[model samples]
Structures are given as structure tokens and as C-alpha cells.
Target: MSTQQTISKHLDKSVIWLFVIVFLISASVFAYRYKNYKTCEDVAFTVKAKEFRVGELIKFTDNTDQAANWEWDFGDSTDVKTNKEVLHIFNKEGEYKVRLLVNNICQDEKTVTIKEKLFIIDSTKLPVFNVKSSIVVGETLNVEDKTNNASTWEWRFGETTRVNSVEKRASYVYKTPGLKTISLVVNGDVKHTTTKQINVLPIEKKEERISEITGTNRRLGDGIKARPLGYEDKDKEKTKDEPSDKPKVVPFIGDSQFISKLELVSNNKLDANAFKEYFCGDINKNIIVNGKNTSFLIFCEKIKNKKLRIKDITIYREKGSNCINTVTISQNKILGIF
Candidate 1:
């Protein structure tokens, strides 16, 4: 064979191999482009509603894997977050159409119903009474009126029931004499009860013991002389008109010359207005001191200080009322007798 012909054949074979390689490379590039191209249905997605309430937080999870973005329409006339756990509030009560659009490719939706819940208020009550002060024992006192709000009433007299009833005015007679506790329960509520002490004394006990004292007229000017007062009852009287117990002092002082008509109390407390009405002048006053009672009468012309300083001193019996042994004292130094 000729050398030029063989060389020409070899060049043609090389050109054919080069063309085959270029064609194969172009086909691979076209196949790669076609594989990567996406349709509208590729990145599609949808969302399903789980559960929600009027004030509850709901989550909308996008179940699509290829979706790039999510759009949530919470159907409450408001837009909500498009995350996995999206929170939304349903203010009104009704069925809601909750819609979700995924990556502009696909759409998913669900419906949920919300309702209103009822609420109640809490309260506390306290008991009350009408009268609460100064209850005397052994006295059948009427109980205070109970209001209509009190549906129940209970009474406890610190003992078994001698008188038991639901009447508003209840009587409780204290059998024994001492401090007694009384309780009243109203409307199933208990309150701190009050205590009343009864002072019971015998009925036939003697009442008055103080007897009147009189002195001679010539010796009366020696600063008003009088013996130590003694108690006398009806039988053991030193004089015929005296009672015969230990005679208590029946002393009366007034502002006038009339002194015999005033009423004297047993505890040495005297009523001055009665003495003043019996006497003519203004009844200055009288008081008891050191187991002795004395009376005074001072005129307005004899006033020294702005206030009258009436001296009520202790008086010892000056030996058959010859001269009364006494000590001068201020007004505050003696027990007051009005």
C-alpha cells in the first residue's frame, strides 16, 4: 500500500473518535439539565388542624418535605405565625377555616370550633348581733332580734336547757349566783360569748345602820364638834328612838340653819339638793372621812380662793363630845360623799 494513503486513513479514524467523545459530553449535559428542572407539583404542601379553643395556642405543622415557605390563614379574620408551633387566639365562638399555603406550590387546610366557658364568683360571710353590751344576770332579758339572713339560731346558757325555743325574745333565768357565760349562734356560725355576774343577796337583810348625832348649842361653835359615829339597830339602842344595831353615822350638812330634815345614806353618801331644799341657804356640801361624817355650810362672802376649799378631816371622839379631836385636811384627802 502507498504511505500517503495509509496516513490519510489514520487521520480519518482519529477525527471519528473525537466527534464521538464531543457528542457523548453534550448528551450528558442535556440529561443533567432535564433531571434538575422542577414542576409546580414538586414543592407542594398541606396543613391539618389539631385542636384549638377561644384562648388556646394551636400549632400548624407543615408536613411537606420539599416546601420552602408556609402561609397560615388562621380564619379568625387574622393572620398568624407560620412556624411548626404557631399560636393563634380565637376571640369569637364558631367554626373556623384555618388555611395553610406551602411554598406557593400546594395548599392544606383544617377547620376547628371554639366555645366560651362559664365563670363563677367566690364569697365569704360573717355573723352579726344587734345588742352586745351590759347584760345583767338573773334577769329574764330579751335577746336581740335576729335578721332574716340568719337562717338558724342557737342559744347556750352554759348548762342544760331550762328554756329552749326559737323565739327572738328568749328568757334565761340564772339558777345559781356567779359569773355566767351566754352564747348565741346564728346561721350555723359561732361568736365569742359574753359573761354576766350576778350579785345575789338575801331579801330579809337590814338596810340602814347610820344614826343621827346632835350636840348642845353653846359647844357647837368650837369648829362643829361631834362624837365618833356609831351604828345602832332597833333593839340595842342607847336612846329610846335609836335602832338596835351598830349605828352608822347619819350626818347631814347644809348651807342654812335648818339641819334636822336632810336624808342621810348608809354609805355616808348624802344627797345635797334634798338638804338644800330642806335648808334655806345654798347647801355648800358634806363628806365622810375616817369613819366619821361631817357637814359644811359656807357663805359666798367668806370665799378666799376662786374655788371653795372645804376641809373634811378625820374626827376622833373628844371625851363625851366635850371637844371634838380633829385634824385639818384638804378636799382631796377624804372619800367623796355626794
Candidate 2:
């Protein structure tokens, strides 16, 4: 072969070698990228919570690529959960290492710091309030602010579920004869408020009776006789001396005395049933804390474990009956009492 022909053959061999090298490099790059993309498809999860406090429910959701099975370990010694989306609660507060295992192979973890729940209302922090206890129907009740910095006040007299009066000092009158609940919100802090109950009495009425002597005209019959004047007087004296059989009146517990008992009940359970007769024979009977009407049970719960300052209490009775139908209280109430 000639020198030029040999040189051309060598050039052709070099070009083929370069093309083969380029193909190999491209294939290697593609394979490396595919491997990394597969790795990115591994199992993953997320945790959601309203608050990191004990007794709060926490949510765990799986987000694994092509995941078929899921297992959750809350790390709080709870049951091993098996669900794509699961809820968990931790009884005790502490740092928990939550883990999610998918398909029994891939895993992810999160650390949750749980805290202790707190009493939402601090009654000790509330300001003192005052209102007149003797609230009568058709009479205006004046609610006075005893503390400083109170810019607004909203009062509800339990007649209706609406704010009847709003001012730094408010006045309201209850129309019906029932347990009346008075609510006071200061400075628009609706969450925390002062609640009072007062019994509005009906209009007073007086009852009177007149007695008179009567003369009787009698005719003497064959077998009838008239008693002697002295004998009749003696009979009257004996009848007066004999024991009377009239039923004695039942004792009544006045409203003022019941107010004393409630003032002492701060957080203690008192004998509210002592006045059951006044409340139609059931102390637990719903007497309005009067939530624009709060139940007696909820009112008791709100006063638990707190120092309560009672401003006043009123007892309202029916015009002719000794039974009390309404009672009101004024106090510095905790935030959640109502």
C-alpha cells in the first residue's frame, strides 16, 4: 500500500475510537443519574399538631414513593400503629422520637417536644368588681367599676341572652321572677369576665283579714236546751287552753343567709340542698349562673380551685310564697367560669 492510503486508514481508526469513547461517557452519565433518582424515591413522612402538649392529638402521614405498607412508632410506649395516616396521644409530657417505617425497610423520624397543659383561667389575675345586691324588678341595677383601667363593661341581666348594658358602669333590671344571671365583661375581654346572679323580687302585696262578733237567734225545741252563759264561757276557756292542732309553719332559709353560705364556698362544695324547698326541692335544679344562662354544675366547676371574691348575692321570692325563685351573685369571675 502507498503512504497516503496508510495514513487515511489510521485517521479512520482514530475517529471510530473517539466515537466509541463518547458513547461510553454518555451511557455512564445516564446510569449515574438514574441511580440517584431512585434514591430520592425513598420513604418520607410528616407530623402535624395543633399544640405540642400532653393530651393533644398528633397526626402522622406517610409520603413514601410507591409505599404499600406503613408502621408508626410514637416512641411513647403506645401501641405500634399500622396506618397510612395515624393519630396518637402521649399521656406524659416529654421529648418523643416519632418514627415512620414504610414497607418494613425505609424509615424516617421526627422529634416532638410535648408540654404540660395549663389552667387557662387565672382568677387571681382578674380585677375586682362590684354591683348592688338588692336588685328588684322594675328597678335599675348599677354596676360600678372598683378597679382602675377599665375602659368598657358589658352587662347581661339574664333576662335575655343579649348584652343589656355596656359602659364603664352599667345598669339593668330583670323583669321576671327566676334565678337571674348577671354577666360583666370588662374592656372587651369576652374570654374573662365577672358574673353575678341576683334574685329580682315581685312587687310587694299586703294581705289583711277583719273579724267581728255574731249574735245567733235560736228557738227551744222539745229535746234541745241552751247552755248557761257561765258554762259557755268556761267551755271557751277550756277550748283555748287545749293544745291547738293547726299545722306549724315550715322554717324558711332567708336569701341573706344563703348568700353567706355561697360566700364561704369559694372552692368548697356546700350544702346547697339545704335550701331545696325554696328551689322546688332540687338544689341541682338548673338555676340560671343565669351563660347569658350558665348551669349550676358548670358554675360550680368554674369556681373550683380558685379564690373567689363575692361582691353580693340576692334572693327573690314570690309575692305570697316563701319559696325563693331567683338568686343573684356578683363576683370577680374567672375567664372560663361561664
The most accurate candidate by TM-score is 2
Q: After superposition, how far is residue 218 of candidate 2 from its true place, in Å?
A: 9.9
lDDT of 2 by residue, 1-338 (tens): 99999999999999999999999999999999666543325677888989877788888888877777778888978788898999888887668998887776678888998876533665653546765555556887776766457777666665543467776666666665645656666777654656665666776777766688686766667558687666657677888899766533334676567666564554466534445455543233344442234434335445656667666666666555455655666665443443
Candidate 1 per-residue lDDT over residues 15-93, each given as its tens digit? 9999999999999999996776433353323433344434655555655665556678777778556664465667765
Clashes of each: 16, 5
Per-candidate Cα lDDT values, in order, are 0.44, 0.65
Error of 1 at 130 (Å): 17
Error of 1 at 236 (Å): 94
- TM-score result, candidate 1: 0.24
Q: Model 2: clashing residue pairs?
A: 196-329, 197-328, 197-329, 198-328, 291-294
TM-score, every prediction: 0.24, 0.41
Model 2: lDDT equals: 0.65
